[model samples]
Each structure stands twice: as C-alpha cells, then as structure tokens.
Target chain A: MEALIEEPGTADTTWESRLEAKALIPGTSTGVAFKLWVGGLLLVLLVGIVAYVNQYNNGLYVTGMRDRISWGIYIAAFVFFAGISMAGTLMSAILRITRATWRTPITRVAEAITVMGLITAGVFVIVDMGQPLRLYQMYLNGNWQSPLMWDMMAITVYLTSSVVYLLVPMIPDLAFFRDRLPGRVPHVQSWMYGTLSFGWIENPPQRRALAKAVAILTVLIIPVAVSVHTVLSFVFSTTVRVSWNSTSFGFFFVAGAIFSGVAVLIIVFAIVRRRYHLEEYITERQFTYLGYLLAAMSMIMIYTNATEFITKGFKASDDDLFAFRELFATKFAPLFWFYFFGGLVLPVLIVAFKRTRTITGLVVASSFAVVAMFIERYFIVVAGMSVPLMPYEPSSYMPTATEWAIVAGGFALFMLFLTLFTRLFPIVAIWEMKEEHETRVEVAP
Target chain B: MIVDLRHCDGCQSQGTAPQCTLATIEGHLLPEPMEWIEVYESPLEGGGTQFVPTPCQQCQNPPCVNVCPVAATFSAPEGVVLIDQDRCIGCRMCMAACPYDRRFFNWGSPPVPPEALLADYSMEHQVQAKVGTVTKCDFCVDMVRAGSLPHCVAGCPQGAIYYGDLEEDLATNGKTLVSFKDFTTNNNAYRLKEELGTHPRVWYIPGHGEAVGRDPHTTGRMPTKWPWIERAKGAVTWKR
Candidate 1:
C-alpha cells in the first residue's frame, strides 16, 4: 500500500525491493483490499459469463420473459447503470458551472465513473439483444421513426462526450504522473504520458488553455447526460402501452436516474477514501455536501413518484386500475413501498436530521437510496407488463437462474472496471488537490 | 343479398365438402342458435334475439398490422388480414391491438398429432402449427386464392357469411349472390363499429322472422373431426 503513494525523493531502495520482494511480502493495506475487491469482482464476472452462454444456448426463455414481458432483468440493469452514469457527469458539471471551490477533490473521480458507467450500460444493451451478433442491423436498417434509434444516438453521443470530458481534465495529472514516477518504468508509459501532457510545463498560457477546455466540456456534458436518459425513457413512453404512455415518464425517469446516480457516487467514493486512507485529501465537508445532495435528490424522487402514481391513480380506467392495483396493492406492492419509504423517504429523513450528519450516517442513507432505486426499477418494469389486457388470467413470470447470473455478472463487471481503473490512475485528482491547496494558501497570504 | 332468416330453415344443405353453414366443430346450429352464427336476445326498439353470423372482418386499415414490429400480422393487397408464423416473434402486440379479441397465440405446439405433419405447411393453409406463435382467422385465403368460395360461405344454407371481391364489387353466398354495393344498400346492411374506421369487409344484415333467438346446439350435432377448433377454447384460460 506504501507503493500506492510513492515517496518521490527516496533513493537507492526502489530497485532493491523488486529483488527482495520474492522473499519478503509487502504489508500494504491498499494491496490486500484491492486484491479482495478484484477477487469478488472476478467471481461475479464468472457467473455472468456462464449465464450469457446459457442464454445463447436456450434463448431468452432463461429470463423471466414471455411475449407479454419481452424485456426483463437485462433491460432494467441497463437502466440502472445508465442512471449511475448520470451522477458523475451531472455532479461534475454542476460543480464546474457553479464554480464551487470545494469541488476539487471529487470531480475527476466522478468523471471516471461516468465514462465507465456509460460503457457498461451500453454493453448490457448488447447482452439483452436477441441477436447480439446482428446488433449492427439496428444501425444499418434503423428506423428513424422509432424511439430506440433515438436512444442509440443519444447514448453513443453521451459515451463519446464523457470519455473526452474525463480525459480533458486528466492532461495535467498525466504530466504529474509522468514526472513523478521513477525513470525506466517503460518507454511506452513514458511516451503516453509525455504525448497526453500536450507539452504542458505549468506555464500560464498552457494552464489557461487546459482550464478553458475543461470548463467548456463541463458545460457541454450536462445536457448530453440529460438527453441520454430522457431518450431512453422515450423508448417506452412513445409506445402506446397504457403504463408507458404518460407524458411525465421522461422527467420521472431522469429524476430517478439522477437520484440513484448520486447515491452510487457516495458509496464508491466512501470505499475509495477508506481503502486509500485519503482522509486528509477528502474531508468530512465532502460527506456533508454529498448528504445534502442526497437529501435534495430523495425529495425530488419522492415528488416524481407521487406525481406519477397520483395522476395515474386519478384516471382509474380499467387498465389504469389494474396497473395501480398491481403496483400498489398486489404482487409488486412490497417492492413499490420499499422503494418509496426506504429508498427515498427514509434517506431524506436521515440526511435532513441533525443527529445523523456524520460520514457513516450519510453513507448508510445513500446506500439505502441506491438499493431502493434498483428495486424501484424492477417494480416499474415487472408491474407495468404483468397486468393482463384481455379478460384472460394474467401470465406469471419468474426469472430463472440464468437471469440471476447475468444480473450478478453485471454488478461484478462494475466492480471489476472500477478496481482496474484505480490501479491505472489515481483515485483522487492529485494535481487538482495540490492546486486547491496552493490557491487557498495564496489567498490567506 | 340479405339473409331472409324467416324463410330459411336451420338445415343448410347447399354447403361444400368439409364446410357447415349452421354448425361448427365447437357446437351445433339450432333454431334458438348457440353456434358461430348465433342470434342474440337483444332488446331492440323492436325487441328480439337477433341472429348474426360473425366471421373474420378482413379489415382494410387493420389495427393489428400497425402495432406488429415484426410485420407478422398484415393486410394483403386484397385487404384480407393474415398472420405469417415464420416471421412472428410471438410478442403478442397484434393480440393487444385487436379490439375484437380475435387473435390467439399457441401456448403449446397446436395439438396436431404426428400423423398430421404428413400434410404440407402452407401460408395459405396452416396445416401444422408450432407452439409460441399467434393464430387467427385468415379470411379463408386458401379458398379465395383457388377461386372458390370460403367454407363458411358455402356451408351457410341461409345465404349468410358471403365471400366477396371488394375490388370487383361482387359477393356470393352459395344460395344467393349479388353486387356488393347494391345488396348492402337494399338490405340496410352495416359493418360493426364503422366509426372506429377499421374498414371491415364483413357486413351484417339483421335477422328476420323465426330464425331470431334460435339455439343451434339444440338442433344440430357439433363436428368432431377438426380438433383445431377444440384447442381454440384453451386460449380462453388467459383471463384475469
């Protein structure tokens, strides 16, 4: 773990450790925690691979999918991951837009999560497709009239913009990594950092150009993220299906996604801070701000849910009545109420209270909110499709082992991506933290 | 021409082979009918149980077609609604769009014993069915393509359930045939729910005289050879 934070001026002991490393084991906490995290992720990935193979062999029958319930776990997971992605970009953009001084420590990590989250979300879509190999068909023979095409366009654009947004902020950091690391690491590694540094030498002109680019990107990414989820909602909302036909669906989906996204960010950042012992860098103030954000999002989520249900419940036609009864009083009632109370309402109360304002308390509330968001997504999908339109008895669907496996795999993939990410780059934005400190000291002077 | 329900007896003798005008595999036609062409005991401004022989509407602007993503259910250029099983994803979007609740998806491979597979599979006539796809009345497209009247049309002794060319403006039941427009106007015939604009090809003429409120099951024997109709009853199990 000591290697995780390299001591720059230490001499003559670096190359010697590599020779004695075989005999002597390093006792770094970062190394042990990282290994354990990577191992857990691998287990999940294995489950996913097995599930995907089964799906290929047995077709979509492995899922809780019937003709009426054509989409199930895969689509919901895609929506969940996409919602998480919205947090990183939106939170970063908000901070940048407001010119928040305290946003320094968390911004780059959030952007990293954003890029990774969107990529995985896109992967889930392919996994859900009946013909993954023929996925190009959608682009080749895509119907412009269909809302799915709109989703494709929006997600692709968002993914590209997010990668650029993430990388643009890292140019200065890559230069730091290049100079700070010992020489003779690798020619390619040196070349990569050297090239990406764009000849940046901490000059005023260079700093101004990098800052200007990041500011512009931050401004651009907010609308693009909003567009991604709004268009995703359009895939269902544009359909004539009774449950999905509401005008409020787009905003409702977006709000839920943002709420969940912030929750995930809190959890991930908390773990990273704890594992890396980044207490000095990431102070308690960060937790307080995140708690405030969570409280705000929880309120918004509660408002959206009430609006959707109240409006839908008011116009109690036969279809509407059946849908409402299914969600509020029948099989999905438990999940629905759990998401409402535990996911949104409880989290809001905890965050708003004076007693539970600590980092641990906020983490606990945010975790519940994220978990609740997942349950909410599941209920939305299952309840909406489970209601029978005809006078016939409604069909019952239960996801098989294969479906469960893929869901496990998706979560595994998320952890794997994040774990790999930390090893390759700094979890906290090193240059930004230094800059924030420098600026503060200069102001005081 | 209008089916003169008063003069027409329930015994339909003019039907072609494998076709029954008054009775079907499910039930028999009776004077107080309980058959496909059943008369409803509806309170009219005039009051009576009306006899109406219902068949596949063969709509021009079919609702089922518009909602099908896979284009499985579609209207032919000649305006007969049909289902192509090969292309169907079994998504049941067509079943949801159909207001009449006429479409059915095969829950299990249609119960044709192995011997039936000896017959060829044709889009014109679905001889063997696979499970997990939709089925519905195809307006007897097979007979229409062969230049013969539909089985239901030939079976009707009362000159009900006509096969017609909407393009040619001609219609024929076995007993009586007439120009489509002239007969429609002369008989005060009307399509069901014309306001919905489905553009249904099937027209109904109100029952007359003794044929009203007749139960066909009391008078006729239900056919047993075609087991496919018996399986259609299984579709009714999907109700909430």
Candidate 2:
C-alpha cells in the first residue's frame, strides 16, 4: 500500500502493489450483472433510435407540439440535462479550487456526468428541431444577436473545456493503467490508455506542468459553467412571453442548475460508491457534507421560486393572471405543486432530521430531487408556452409516445456513456486520493 | 394596411365568413387552421365585443426577425417581415417570438391546392409550402408590386380594410382613396402592442361593428375554410 501511494517516479514499486491497483480497473473480469445492465441500456437506446427515425420520416406532427405550444418535453429534457451538467463544475472545479480534501473520490463521477449530460443535452436540441438536417444553417448563417447562437457557442466551449478538465487530472492514472495492465487488458484498451496518458513519466517538471494546467482549468471552468446556464436562460427571457420575461431569469436559472446539479451528483455518488465497493473512500462523511449542500440548495430554490412567483403574482396583469392560473390552479397545477412540495420541500425535511440523514435517506431525498427538478423543467417549458399569446384560449400540450421514447433514449444514452467511461477509466481519481492520503499522513503529529 | 374596426362586422352582415380571411386563404392556397388574415372578436372594456381583423403587424422592429438564429426571417426594405422558408431550419424561435400569434408552422407536409405547387415560390409570395417551416401574412407584396390591392383589402364587402404606401402618403380600400395622414388622424388610428415598440405598419381604428349595423352581442363569425378541391399527395393538416 505504501509503495503504491508513493510518487509514480519511484522505481522501487512492487508487483503486489500493481496487482492491488489493478483491482480498481473494471471490465477486466466482467460480471453477469454488469453485462445485463449494459445490454438493457443498449436495448433502450435502440428503441429510441427507431422512434427518432419515425419522427424523422414523419414531421414534428407526430409529437405533441403544435403552433401555440411549439416546444414540448424535448426542450424540457434539454434544460434538465444542461442544468445537471453543473455537477462537474461544482464537485471537481469549485471543490478543487477551494481545496476541499474530501472531493477526491467523487470528482471523476461528477466530471463524467457533466460531459455525458452535455452530449445528451445537445442531442435533444437536434431532436427538437423540425428540420434536423438543416442544422448546419445554424453555423453558416448564424446570427450573433440570437440567444440560441450564444447558447450553442457557450455549450460547445463548455463541453470542450470540461473534457480537458476531466482528462488532465487523470493523466497519471491513465499512465498507471498503461504500464500495469498492458497484457492483462485488450490491445485496443492498452493502446488507448498509452496514447491518452501522453507519455507521462511523472517527473518533477511534469508534475509542475500538470498542476499549473489543472489550476488554470479549475479557475476557468466555474465562469464557463455559469455562463452556459445564464445564456440558456436568455433564450427564454429574451422573448416577449409574459411567463418568460424576467430580469432575474439569468440568476434564477443558474441557481436552479446548481440545485439540480448537486442533487444529481449526490445520487450518482451514492450509486457509484455502493456498486464499486468504494465505502472506504466515499464514506458517510461525504454523504453528510453533500446532504448539507442539497439542503442549502433546496432553500435557495425555494427563495428563488418565491421571488419569481410573488413578484409576478403581485402585479397580476391580465396576462400574468392567466399565467398564474395555469401554473397554480389550472392544467399545470398538479405538476407545479409536485415540484414545489415533493421536489423542493421534502428534501429539506429529509436532511434536517438526524435519523433520515443517513446514506439511504439522502439517496431517497436526492432521487425525489432529480425527479422533481425534471418536473420543474417540464412545467417551465410547457406552462410558459401554455400562456395564451393572443386573446384566444390557451393551448395545451401532452408528450406523445414518440417524444417519451426519444426522452428515454436520451437518458439511456447518458447512462451508457457514463457506464462505458467507468469500464474504460477508474471512476475514482487514484492519484488524487493518494495525494490526499499523503497530505493527511504528513499533517498527523 | 389599416383595419377600420368600426366598419368590420367580421362578415356577419354579409352572411359569409370574414371576407378578408377567406380571400387571403383562397389567394394563398393556405392549409387548414392557417387563417393568414384572421378576424378576432375581443371583448371591449365597457361592455361587449369588437371584431379586430388582424394580419401580420409588419413591425419595423420585428421581434421574430430579432430572434431568428439563421436570419431566415428578415425585415424587407418594404418594412414587411418575410420568411424565406427555403432557408428556415424550423427551430420555431421566430414563432415563439411573434407577439401577434400571426405566425403558423407547417408541422407536416402542408396540404396546399395542386395549383399552388406549380406557382414559383418567393418570400414575397410564399407558395409551394414547405414542411417544417414557418409561414405568415406577407401583406400581399406580390399584388402590391403589380399595382393592385391585397386580396383582403379588395375582398372586404364593407370596404373596411385599406392598402397604402406610407412614403407615397396615399391609401385606398379598392373603391375609395384617401390621404393616409388625414385618414389616420381623423379616425384616431392606433397600432397593436405599441408598448412593445414594434412600430407596426398595420393600424386599427378601434370600434365595435357599430358602423356596419351589426350588434356586438352577435359574437361568432363563420369558420374559415381552405377551399382546396384537391390537396397535394401525402399532405396533411393540423390545428394551430
């Protein structure tokens, strides 16, 4: 264990330490359960592909979207995925910048979530397009004045920078896998690790360079993440719709993104910790700390929700009255209340109590949060569109089977990417954990 | 364009659908639920209803044009907001941005008359309707270029609609010609949603159907129709 924890430049590391590190590498000895899980995800992905083909063959008429309610669950899913992508910025970048020692075990999971969430979010945007093939026009005739162009540019930059952020800290770990698991794994896997490791010898100069790169990225990613969500909010706020027109929209959306992001991170952490037998690294202490975050975010969400509603409801213009009716008492009331009580309030209560603050309790709270945030996004899109733009009656929308299938596919794709990432790379940052361990040992009297 | 709401009875007295809506639909070969020029009966503040013949506002500061990611929809030099369906990606950002709800989407293949398929397509006269793109009232720029009134202005039985050139300072509703400035000033004309600063070219002289001797309590108008004898193959229609 001592030899394994030592700097990678040390030549005296024993074969036994390599074998112990090798256990962290998944897919070497695949279990039936893992195979079954992957197979199921792929099967769902296949169904989604078939449904999307049908939607393509037909036009957007197959979906629930119509003239008045031109957007639907697809846009909601896009916002949901984009919102959860804040996980990496919060857990990896912000935590790293702040020197939060306990974040080592979960950074890999959070960063992977960010990348996969963004990729799936991008897919939904394409799926929502009536002329998916004409998407190139966005680049060729792109209007810099459009909020959507800003969104496209922001997401692209965020995705590219996040991939770099995820990969930079993993260089040493990839090098470890490259050297230790060469013949043990497939040649393609071995080659990938070797190529991705970028010829790391882990000398002092290389360490200094890697540290500097990570420090720069760690500082840069937070603003990028915030800007991505803020720009997304501008897509709605810039419009003239009564429900969407708000000066507070940018800040409100960022708060919501981080709220949903932390909830998803907690959920992913719990699953990864149990599934990978990482109890030693991801302890109850991490869960407790994240629970506090979840609780705090829930409070922020409540406050923002109140501010948005109270400000609008107090004014009660003819348009505002109709919008309030639709959200609070009419067609969308059930969804709105579900999100308000079950998604926001219940999580706070779970974390506030001592007995239910255990890992199981927090996971339950987080699950609610995840489902509720999705509902919140749904209402935001659907209810905002439901507000009658004209004097005519408000239009309604319900997701068709095709939309539901495609949404399922998006989620499956997200899970599949995350699952494949875990099989290929260590979900835990081994080097970071080693560094944390070393620091703790040195600090001990 | 000026819509004289005082004379507009929504074609109630004429005992037909709003002539403006019918004429524009027939002229453009528009599909079902796409009334390019719709007659909306809105409630007045004091008591009863008023018939507002609403077409595209032709805003100088068009919100739809501002939000279009591809610049597919743009304000022509004529100050009419026109959509190039060929270039539109059908993201519907413009549709959402349109305050009037005048914009319509061809969700599926639009069911146009077979003859409409033969007409050469242009932004000034949107024909050969494309699937997955937005369409709206183009203010009959094609007819205007030919030195003729728009179908809606010419078709109004009560001469309630007017076509005019602001630069020329002249206006006409087929039978009668008037000075544009004098007509607007005398009638106290106002544009819809002027608070939004869209600076719409279409003006309304607000009133119930009082001048045409139709009661405000007579609320409903005849439902508009597409009047297609034969729709193109594999074409479909959907609700707004």
lDDT top scorer: 2
Q: What stretches of model 1 exceed 4 Å from their correct place?
A: A1-30, A182-205, B1-240
Clashing pairs in 2: none
- lDDT on C-alpha atoms for all candidate structures: 0.65, 0.87
Report lDDT (Cα) of residue A444, candidate 2.
Answer: 100
- On TM-score, the leading prediction is 2
Assess chain B of each prediction and give its TM-score: 0.72, 0.96
Model 2 agreement with the true structure over A178-243: per-residue lDDT tens digits? 877777679999999999999999999999999899999999999999999999999899989999
Q: How well is each residue in A1-445 modelled by candidate 1, as lDDT tens digits? A: 3455445564356432322221111111235666887888898899889888877655554566655555676777888888888877866887768877676777767878887888888878877755456555455544455456678788989989988887777887767656654363456666776787777788999889888998888888888888888988876665545777689888988888888888888888788777655665567888788888889988987887778778878877778888888878887888888888888888888888889988888889988998888887776766666665433356766677888888888888887887766655545566666676767778996
Question: Per-residue lDDT of B26-74 in model 2, one digit per residue for the tens?
Answer: 8888877888888888898876789999999999999999999999999
What's the TM for model 1?
Answer: 0.74
Q: Which window of ten consecutive residues has the lowest lDDT sum in model 1 chain A?
A: A19-28
TM-score of 2: 0.96
Q: In model 1, how large is the Cα lDDT of residue A415?
A: 76
